[model samples]
Target chain A: MMKIVTRNLITYATLLLAYTLLFRFGLSSLLTAEKWIWVKVIAVIYGAMIFVTAWMTGRRDGKENFLFDAGFRWNLTTGIVWGLVSEGWFLLGLHSNYESIRMIHIPLLIWSGFLVLHFSLFLILKRRTIGGVHKTDIFE
Target chain B: MTTNDTFHEDLLGAWEETYKKGQLTLWIFLSLKEGPKYVTQLQESIALFSKGTIRAEEQSLYRTLRKFYHLKMVDFSSGKGHKGPDRKYYHLTPLGQSLLQSFVERNILLFFEEPLKDLLLS
Candidate 1:
């Protein structure tokens, strides 16, 4: 549903924002340019977009369903997309310092952020499976 | 609290069944704990914590969540909506929380145990 999509957007967006801030002000020293404000703004914009997707999804599920279990598929899909965006384009661009701003370094930044989150969620899901998993899943 | 005086026993019963039936267990627990929270909150919660069933499948999760609401283990509130009105809310009974606590506690501790914690790598 549109709602779930929006929710996923928001979740991804918020996480992106957090990372942007962390890299910008929190870890701004790494950036050669300290005067740039685009990082924060862009992070908020795109980050919010991600959060929106998560929020919308949440709304669609309405806390009644086990979205935790189902959300994994996206993780795989997101991973493939992120791999291309993050390592693929990112290294290609950042290595040579091509523009490296205004969505230049942004796509991969967002991708990595989502990657970490997705992996974390996967780990959690794996645990829950172990926590509550029955042998049936493995053997049959 | 004493089982006789609290809903813990019933809550645990639900949790036991939760593994067998993922989302339904979660919805039921949420309904008991939060008093009709929006689905947005639940999704965010699961994403953040390793507490319940997540990473299973998308449409299925969506389907089950919807089903519980229809089943009446969950209810919507008049809070408008934080994620949006398009978002629905859920509230769990005290019975539900206690049940969640049982397995959650055990699993949490067990999860942190020897081979699980990666102390070997550490």
Candidate 2:
């Protein structure tokens, strides 16, 4: 569990750093006319990073670690971090008078939908297995 | 090999598989009954005490330990490792000990009764 959380935190931190460098360090200015393009690019990168990190964690931990629902927890933590950073970036863009700053909402809304679906799937799976001893439960 | 030999082998394999499934947990508890142990030590103790009938993967053992920890059946504290960082030494809680005692009395002691003993001997 700690390993999963730590890997997630590191992934989020790296993504956050990349966002800050791109937006706060003149990358936004350089791509003034193509602001939407760059924003979409960042959004894609964020999505990809989340997917990759979650996949790697699942692979490393395997189904044995699901006693705590580690995947769901990972998604929840990732959602929180993604939310905060994107909102902060949007605010920075708003104050800096960057065009199409509202474009950030597109990725935010999509990611939020994904999180809802992930959570629903988790609940369904949990309910289905609630009566039986989890395969991972050695005590069973 | 003959068909009869193959069938006999399959029957024994199936029986062993079913028996081994439930035995792992009992063996784990029995191993902890001796004393607190880290993962490797617990694995070795279980294999030794079970006369090599049970073997557990490291990952599965950790998962079981985590579940036991959460259930308050076991607890652990950091202890020195051979050459690396600290290790968690796990011991059974009072709840676990009582449960084990009850299990032995109810299920195990039955095998020692006169009829069962005579049946086994015969």
**Which residue runs of candidate 1 sit more than 4 Å off their true CA positions?**
A1-140, B1-36, B50-59, B66-73, B82-87, B113-122
Model 1 iRMS: 11.2
* Predictions in order: lDDT: 0.49, 0.71
What is the TM-score of chain A, computed separately for every candidate? 0.37, 0.56
TM per model? 0.28, 0.61
Candidate 2 steric clashes: 0
Q: Please write out the lDDT profile of model 1 over residues A42-67, one tens digit for every residue.
A: 55665565556655655554343333
* Candidate 1 global CA lDDT score: 0.49
Worst 10 residues of 2 chain B by lDDT: B63-72
Candidate with the greatest TM-score versus the true structure: 2
Clashing pairs in 2: none
List each model's interface RMSD.
11.2, 4.3
